[model samples]
Every structure is written in structure tokens, then in C-alpha cells.
Target: MSGSEQAPVVGVSTYRQRAVTGVWDVEACLTPAPYVEGVTRAGGIAVLLPPQPADAAVAAAVLDRLDGLVLVGGSDVDPALYGAGPHDATDPPQRQRDTWEALLVHEAIARGVPFLGICRGAQVLGVALGGTLHQHVPEVIGHHGHRAGNAVFTPTVVTTVPGTRVADILGDGVTAPCYHHQAIDRVADGLVVGARDDDGLVEAVELPDHPFGVAVQWHPEEDLDDLRLFAALVDASARRRTGAYA
Candidate 1:
């Protein structure tokens, strides 16, 4: 492809936490390897967007430089943002990350940038748009299958809603690699459920009005063999870059 048609620049959100690298422990901004690999494998340039002090203006300025945005799974969002108290199982508040990500979600929607949220990323999208979370999936679903803990990922069967972008990409059903304990509850107003599990728990959501806006409770990046979701996001971004998406 020519420079004008080069792969789109896709920004993936990362975690800000302490790490021990080469006997040196320090705070760093990072995400799992799969996230960056997924984007590159799907024909997009990957850029990591770490937590930083940000406002709407900053968010817009950041979005102004990218063709697509991706919110990856990480620590739990503070329940306070959605007007609730913490659930014992919930991870302690990552306030800075929450604030920065929320801004990106809001601004990305307004700008109609292609977006894909994974695991906690899905929850972030919901809360950023006035929705809430179940806090603990096992408590609500009566099953511990959604998350098996100990850095283990449970295999989940997901059924996509017909006529939705997720369905168009993933077909009727897919077994996803999932490790989330908190699920979206009372989905955001403008966002529609795009897929669900047999238990009726929401597995995916999409903004119909946007060129491309989709989020899944499962960790698509974990399944490197299946890059369909990532490819779809990159495809939409490419279309947007070439003025082929309306």
C-alpha cells in the first residue's frame, strides 16, 4: 500500500503499575503482548495509550492523532464512578486509569472512531456511558465459570445477536477465551447488546450509530489463532482512513 493507504494507527490502552525489570522495580505503563500483536497481525500500527492526567480537551487531542481506539482489560474500575459502593471482590480503585479511559471512550464516540473494548474494557464502555456493572459475575449468575481465577481463562460460549456487527464478524456462535468476573449490568442507553451467553449474560455490545463501536466481555486477544475481532476493528479503521466508511 502507498503511504496514504498505509495501515491505520490504532491506540491500545495499557495498565500503569509497578514492575520488576532486570532487578529494577519501578512503575511502568504496559499491556499484555497479545494486544500489540493482535493489532499488528490485523494490519494496524499499534500504539500504547497509558494512564495520564487527562480531560475532554486532552482526550480529543489524543483521538485527533489516531484512526482507532482499543480499551484492553485491566484492573476494576472504581464503583464510585457509577454511584455505588465497592464489592469485596472488586479490585481496589485505579482512579487515574479510569478517568483517562472514560475520557477516551466519550471522545472516541463523539468522533466516530472505530473502537473495540475487551473484558474490563467492555465494563469501562458501559460505565463511561452511564451504565453499571454486576460487580461479581458468580454472585449474579450463580456460577464461577466466567472466571476461574489464578490467571486462568475460562472458555465461554457466546452467541451473537443477528444483524449486529458482532454477528456479522463472528457469525452465530463462538467459544471465547474469557477471564472476567465483572459483567456489564444495565447497559448504556445508546449501546445495544450484540451477544450473550447461554445464561443470558451480555457478552458483547455495539453502538449502532457509529461506524464501528464494539466491546466484548471476553478476551479476544488471548486467542491469538482467532483475530477476527481485531481484524474487523482494523478493517473499519482502514475504511475510515480511506473515506470508505460512512
Candidate 2:
């Protein structure tokens, strides 16, 4: 295939796991299969990026080879990263994943790479950009509608802000599969709210100056029917790879 026709490489962040798969319990780097499926379905080369050393150089090297990034959903962000104390409902933070993904977020921003962050990944993007999180959505909303239970994907109606990229892509009044317990509290500088739920909770955000930097509180990967978000990232990556952004 010609260089311009090559599929854009999209890197996806993974979760570290300790699982018993057979006779032995082992530590492993893993990501949800749906994330890969979504990226591949969007015509991009999906590359799993497991957590690495918390070094800027390493993160930069990894980003240098990719055209786009997907920060997959996982554990809660460490409150300390946003200068807040953890709430009782907050899950124990995954410090290692936190450190590594934070580096990736920084590098991706510095390099102007297109990225999509889902759930916890969205929180990471927010914190990395000097934003704070709600810590516990139940406390603010007084309901667990956003996350009915563990391993459950609750459906919620989210309205996109008119004229925002999210509205342009998903249109207004979108019913999305959501399973998040925390939400952005203080939106970061330069990032604008792209969508929100009926409760007026922030559901999505975008960086106006970025080529394609969007993060959503819902798990788009769980919604197999809609590949628009993933496709947007891939399209942005393809543009970057072919100098369309120039």
C-alpha cells in the first residue's frame, strides 16, 4: 500500500491485571477486547500499549511511533494527582497505571496527537490538564444511575452542547452506555464541555485547539453500533500521517 494509504497506527492504553487463568495466578498487562475491536472496525491499526515506566522519555518514544491514542477505561485516578483527598467510595487508586497514563496524556498533548479517552481515561486527561474530579458521583448526584453496579453498563441520555464536536459527531440527545462513578469537577483550561447528561453532569469534553482531542465519560466501545468517535480519531490520525493538517 502507498504511504498515504496505510492505516493509521492507534495506540491504546491497557490495564495491569493479576488473574488466575488455569492453574497459575499471574500478573499480566491487558485491555478490553472491545477496545481493539472498535479501533479495528474504524479502519485503524490498533496497538496495545501496556503500562510502562513513569518516564517522559519512554512515553515520548512510544508516542513518536503512533498516529493516535485511546486511553481505555480502568481504575480510578489517584486523588493526589488532582490535589484532592479520596472519598470513601473511591476505589483504591492504581498508582502505576496512573503514573504511566499520565505521562502518555502529557506526551500526546505535547505532540498534538489525536486521542479519545473513555471513563477513567477521561479523568486522567482531565487531571493531566490541571482539572479536578468529583471523587464520587453518588455524593454529588445522590444516585447510582451512572453506574448501577460493578460490571454493569447503565444507559443514560446525554445531550451534546450545540455546535460542539461531540454534537456534530453523535448529534444531540444520545443514549449512551455509561458505567462511571466519577466525573470531571473542574474542567481544565482550554478544554470545553462538549456534552452533558440530564442531571447537568459533564459527559464529554474537547480541546478546541487540538487536531482531535476528545474524551467522553461514557464507554463508546460498549456501544458497538456507533463507531463515529473511534472513526473520528482514526480520521484525524490519517490526516496527521498524510500531512493533511499542514
Candidate 3:
């Protein structure tokens, strides 16, 4: 099979990580290896997109080449973007990454590219779509079950709405690894809630009219065993490349 017959290209955004590489301390663009592995396992070519200057042209250029986009999990979004003040528990914001990823999200949506947002990625999608966030889940939910601590993933049970894309993919009742402290507050107009937790917190969303746009508040990449979500994204990317949706 040729390149066109092979898996579609999926761009995964990365966060800035400070590291010591070969005795040189430097800031690096990085994401968990599983983000790449998950996409590959789902038969999609994974491309890591590091934080770039807040340039719409650059973002559009990147989106032009990608069949899909995966907004990987990372730091909290800057509250100012949604006209809110920061919460005490919210982590210090990564403004540069926020700007870059926000542009990518908007560009991908405008181009009708299939995209998946995980954790912070999901929050970014909501904000880009003219939505707001809860800022801190615990404050409203009255618990920290969503995020136990730093570097820890909690097992979460989410229920998908009937006849929705999430329910079609993962069924109604599904359990996945979750590590988030913020969630969608005021959902955007064109989007609809696709899944929720037992606490009634929004867990997933989908843009029904779009070719494929899903954002989940969990880390499916960490599941490793379940590639259904990634596979769905890859399939949608293939369809987009083939002009099946146009």
C-alpha cells in the first residue's frame, strides 16, 4: 500500500518541559510517549507539535498538512482567556502553550479537521468554542475525586448520552483513567454534552455537525488497552483525506 493507503497523519500537541539533556539544562517540547504510541496503535501517524509562536498563519499551515489533531493533556488554561479569575488550587498557567493550542483548535475547527482533546486539551477546546470552565472541580463538586494529586490518575466512571458519538464508541457506561481539576462550565453553542460522570460533571463533548470533533475529560491515551477513541479519530481523518465528508 502507498502512503495514501496507509494510516492518516495526526498531530499531537506537546507541552514545554524543563529537562537536563546531556548535561545541558533546557526547556523541551514533550508529551508522554503513550500519546504517540496510542495513535500508532490505532493506525495513525503521530506528529508531535511543540509550542509555537502565537501565529494564525503558522497554525493554519500546520493544520493544512494534518489529517487530524490531538490536543494532549497539560497545564491549566489561563483564566483570563474566559474572563475569570484563577482559583487557589489551579496550577500556574502556561500562557504560551495556551495561545498556541488555542489557535490550533480554532484553525482545526475552521478547516473541519478531525480532532480529539484530552484533559487540559478538552478545556482548551471548550474555551476556544466560546465556553467557560469551572476553574476548580473540587470547589463545585465538593470533592477532589477527579484529581487525587499531581502525577496521579484516578479511575473514573463516565456515562455517555444515548445515541451520541461517545455512546456509539465506548457504550453508555465506561470507566477510564482521569486526572483533571477543571471542566466545561458554559458549553459552547454548536457543541453538546456527550457524557457525564456520576456527579453530573461534564465528561465529554462532541460537535455533531462537524466531520469529527470530540473532547473527553479523561486520559484515554493512558488506558493503553483501549484504542477505540484513537481509532475513531484515525478513521475520521481518513475520511477527511478522502473527501468523504466534503
Candidate 4:
């Protein structure tokens, strides 16, 4: 390997289609540049996985090739996926993404693949593990300060549980940038809280028994200055590739 060679590759979610307001046909495979750029900056390769045909077999094959999985933040997951009644704020899910990423999360977890999920990614992880969601965190909990409208990408103060995976990586707390209107309500069968807000929302989940699994209700990828997270995931992926993360 050359002096500048990078480590094992990691797969990330892609935005292939989306619903603008009430319209659902405006397709887009969008993603924030920082996801790829940050991974590279941390000496890891980034691979994009579109949200379609993401079957268990396909995911196992991909997991075999890659060392880690990163779930990027975007879109509102269908409230119905978690057995919730119709949400007044429910937006049409990017069906293409819904099926694929959901499958990817299940397959990755089943195969013991190291993984990290951000924002909507965190919500998906919960549902995939047979849990539920509170379609709108503020609507039910009335944690009005959790989300700031108009300029949706405001910051929230998340206090992590001491000794949890997140606090161990990002210190005892961090002010993460959030844009999502939905959050995990049911604590999932295989996941546990790594942090929470004053409102008692599940701000993060960690698979304490899995090789490496963690999810956060914020856009950690958007903050390039937070290389601790980027480095942690890359390090986990490298361990997975070397068969040391088991």
C-alpha cells in the first residue's frame, strides 16, 4: 500500500427521491458533501448505497465487501412503519429509500457490521429493530424548544448518559445540529439510550452487545469540525475489516 493509502470502505445512504411539500414525484439522489468529504479526510473511502432493492441477500453481500455502514440524515420516515396512526405532519416517504435503507439497517445489524446512524438514520434503526416512533417529537411531548422552525437547522443541547457510547466518544454532552421533526419514541428491542434531552426524547441508541452499533438524532456528518465522530466510525470500520471488531 502507498503511503497515502486509505483503510477499508464504508457505505452511506443516498437520497434518490423525495417529496416536496405535497408532491411526491420530484426524484432526487441527494446527499450532503461532508459525508464523503469527511470520511476521506479521516482516511476512509466512501461508497453510496441507493435506497432500492436493498434486500437481505444484497445487504449481506455488500456488508461482506464493506467494513462499516453510515446512515445519513434526511426525510421523514413513514409514521405507519412503526404502527402509528396517520400523522397530520406525515410526509410521503421516499419509498425507494424507505425499502432499501430499512433493509440495509436490518442486514447490517444481523451480520454484526459496525454502523452509525444520524438523524433520520437513527429513527430508521429503531423501527428496523421492531420499535416505534413518535412521528413528531414536539407535537406529542411539547418540547417546543427542541426544534426551532423557520430556520430548521438550529442547535439543541443533548446531554449524553455518562459511560454511554456517545458520551465516551463526544464527551459528556454536545450541542448537535438537528433538522428532523420526528424522533424515536419506543426504545427498540435491541437498542438503549446513550443520551436524551430535557424532554426525555431518546436522543441516541447504542447496541451494547453488538460489535459496534450506535445512532444519534442529529446531523453529526454536517459538522466537519467534529472529527472525533468521523474518526471513531472509521476506526470501527477498520477494526471490522481486520476482523477485530467481533
Candidate 5:
């Protein structure tokens, strides 16, 4: 089969956490089903990358086999990564996952892999690029609208800046499903703001130099009807696989 006819392999980072399931309570590496389904629906094969001992070489070795990478939403990133103390509301640091994903982000960007970040994934991208995060959104925004609680996704209007990859995929405005209590604070030098919420909080970011590096502070997988972001990533992956971007 031709490169274009072959489905691109996209790696989705998994959450390493302790959980109970069918009388087997133990630590597990898992991602929400929607993440896998979204990638598959977008014409790509999804592979889960579970957190383990990771470094630069490890990341490069893993990313070498994939056409694209997806940093799925998950727990809070260790605040120390950006030289800050954790907020009272921040979850305990998942240093293992933090290190793993950060290395992957660097490797993926260095190798020109099509990549997308969602929710916590967005925060990971920001931090990995030397940016800081607003540990608690409510403290900065004076409202809890970003997260309605009870695992519910609040609809927040996000407006994209013109001429950004995010704008190309999501258009000017969209009511994105957001449940994040943290967001990008100081965007790194190389990354540009792609979109923002009505409150002026950074909601998305993009790396202009890369072919496909976009991260949104919303949960797009929750809205099955809107597969624009996933489709865009998969299309980019397909192009990468076919050497179209080369």
C-alpha cells in the first residue's frame, strides 16, 4: 500500500494512576475511551504510550515509530517544573508522567511530528516549552465557569486569533467544552497564543515553526460531532507519513 493509503500511527499518552476494576485494584496506565475513538474516527491508528522511565533517548526511540503524537488530558503537572509552589487546589504532582510527557513533547517537536495537546496536555506543552501555568483559574478569573464541577464540562466560548493553525481548524469562535482549573500563564518564547477565552485567559497555543503543533485548553473529544481538530492532526500525520511535508 502507498504511504497515503496506510493509516498513520498516532501515539496517545496515558494516565498512570491507581484504580479499581473488576476486583483488580491496582495502578494502571489508561486514557479515556473518547481519546482513542477520536483518533480512530479521524483515520489514524491510536497507540497508548504509558509512562515509565523516560529520557531524551527514550522519547526519540518511541517517537521514531509514530507519525504523530497526542498528549491527552490528565492530572496536574508538577509545579516545580516551572519553579513554582503548588496551589492549594492543585492535585499532587505526577512527576513520572510529567517527565515522560515533557521529554516526548521535546522529541516530537525536534523530529517534526504532528502533535496535538488537549486540556492538561495543553498545560504540559506550555510547561515543556518553559512557560508557567496559572495553578488555579478561579483565583485569576474570579469565577468557576471554566469548571462546573462533578466531572461536568462547561461550555466556554473560545475565540481564535487570525492566521493560527487553531484558527484554520476551529474557525473564529467556538463553544469549547472546558473543565480545566489551570491554564497557561506565561507562554514560552517559541509558542504563540492561538486562542483565548472570553475572560482573556489563554485557551490554545501553537508552534509556528513546526508543521503541526497545536494545543487547546479544552476537551474536544467530549464533543464527538466536532472532529475538526482530530481530523486536522490525522491529515497532517498522513502527510508526514507520505513525506508530503518534506
Candidate 6:
């Protein structure tokens, strides 16, 4: 590797440019965009992921250079991706997100690279690995208080399991800001919940044997909570960058 090359490069997901609430309009090198800021504050350079249908090999090559991958939260996944029919709360899902994130997530896991999924990103990682999500958190579960807005933040408590990565990273328990209506339902295969809400919502999950993977249904980049997970991800990624994996 060239000495001038950056250390610990992380690929971040960008929404497709389309209609409102369709695909996320993610631009290039856009730093401090909530989740991207979360990654940056943790000591990793954030690379915005854009949908490029004509460059699979090039994308894979670029992905190969990174030490880790991050799937940021945005639009809801298409109901059809899962085995369920469109529920009453189903919205127009982001197809590009499914395509790009799926490729990146599988590649990252296969390469023993560390990955962290937050909110929709978490659901993406979960569903990509054979899990499910509740169409709407409010429609069934009575858990309320999570509001949707860039300027507003919501609150909820999450109980962490001792000895779990989520617990060790954030310590004991954490209640992060939540804005999503969809959540993990069946719990992805090979993954386990590390935290939960009083209403039984799956707040966080961890991969049993990957380099380092965790998907959370809450948003920890809201500045309301202590950002421990980001630093942990970056540190683990740095280790991976230095051939420190078992």
C-alpha cells in the first residue's frame, strides 16, 4: 500500500437522486451530514456512496481500498425485498439503496471488514442477512415519542445485555434518538439483539462472528447521546487496516 494513501477509508451510502422521499439525494464529499459526521468524529474518513449502475468492478475495487463500510439511515426498504406483502404503512421504498447497500454490506462482511448500520441502515444490514422489520413502530407497538425532522430530536431508553458489544461500547444502557417507524421484527440470522426498549422494540444488534458489525434502530448521531459506537467502529477498522484481525 502507498504510504500517502489515507488510513481507514469507510464507504458511506448515498440516496439516489429522485423524487422527494424516494432515494436520498446524496452528493459527493458531503461531510458532517449527520451519520457521516458521526463517522468523521470517530476518526474515519467518510466516503459518500453514490448509485452507479455502470461501474460494478470499479465500485468493488474502490470498496476494496476501504478499511470499513457504513450504511447510513435514510429511506425505508421495499416491502417486497422481504417476504411480506405491502402493509398499510408501507411507503415507496428506495430501490437503489437496496442494490448498492446489499452489494457493499455483503462485500464488507465477506472481506472481514467492519460495518455499522444505523436506523434504516441497521434494518438494511439486518434484512440483508435474513431478518425482518415491523412496517410501522406506532401502528402495532405503543412506543411513541420518536419524531421525524432534521432539526428535532426524540428520546427512548434501550437496555443493553451485559458482555455484548453494544453494552461494552456504550456501557450498561443507552437511550438514543429515534426517528424511524420501521424496526427489526424476526431478528436477522447469525445476529442477535444487544439492546431493547421497554415496549420490546429491538434497539440494537450485533454480528456473532464478523470482523465487527452492529445495526441499531436508533440514531446515535443526534448529538444528544455520547458517541461511543463511532469511535469503536473507527478503532476496530484501524486494527483491520493494520492486519490485526484473527
C-alpha lDDT (0 to 100) for residue 133 of candidate 4: 85
RMSD value for candidate 5: 1.3
* Candidate 2 wrong stretches, greater than 4 Å: 2-5
Model 3 ranges with Cα > 4 A deviation: 1-5
Cα RMSDs, all models: 1.3, 1.5, 1.4, 3.4, 1.3, 3.9
lDDT of all predictions, in order shown? 0.93, 0.90, 0.90, 0.80, 0.94, 0.77
Q: 130 in model 4: Cα distance from truth in Å?
A: 1.1
Candidate 1 residue-wise lDDT, 52-122, digit = tens: 99899999999988999999998898999999999999999999999999999999999989999999899
List of clashing residue pairs for candidate 6: 15-24
Estimate the overall C-alpha local distance difference test score of candidate 6. Answer: 0.77
The alpha-carbon deviation from the true structure for residue 157 of candidate 3, after best TM-score superposition, in angstroms, is: 0.8
Number of backbone-clashing residue pairs for each candidate, in the order shown? 0, 0, 0, 3, 0, 1
> Which residues of candidate 4, in runs, are more than 4 Å off?
3-6, 18-27
lDDT of 6 by residue, 132-194 (tens): 889888876765466555646577888998888888888878768878888888987788788
Judged by TM-score relative to the true structure, which candidate is superior, 1 or 6?
1
Q: Write the residue-wise lDDT of candidate 2 on 164-241 in tens digits.
A: 888888987689999988999999998999999998999999998889889999999998788999999999999988
Model 2: per-residue Cα lDDT at residue 192:
94
Candidate of highest lDDT = 5
Q: Residue 4: error of model 1 in Å?
A: 9.2
- Per-residue error at 201 for model 3, in Å? 0.5
Runs of candidate 5 with Cα error greater than 4 angstroms are: 2-5
Candidate 5 lDDT over 16-94, as tens digits, reads 9888999999999999999999999999999999999978999999999999999999889999999999899999998
Residues 1-246 of candidate 3 have per-residue lDDT tens digits of 886466789999998979787988998989999999988888889999999786999999999999999999988999999998998977788888999999999999899999999988889999988999998899898999999987789999999999889889998768979888889999988888999999999999999988889999999998889999999999999888878875
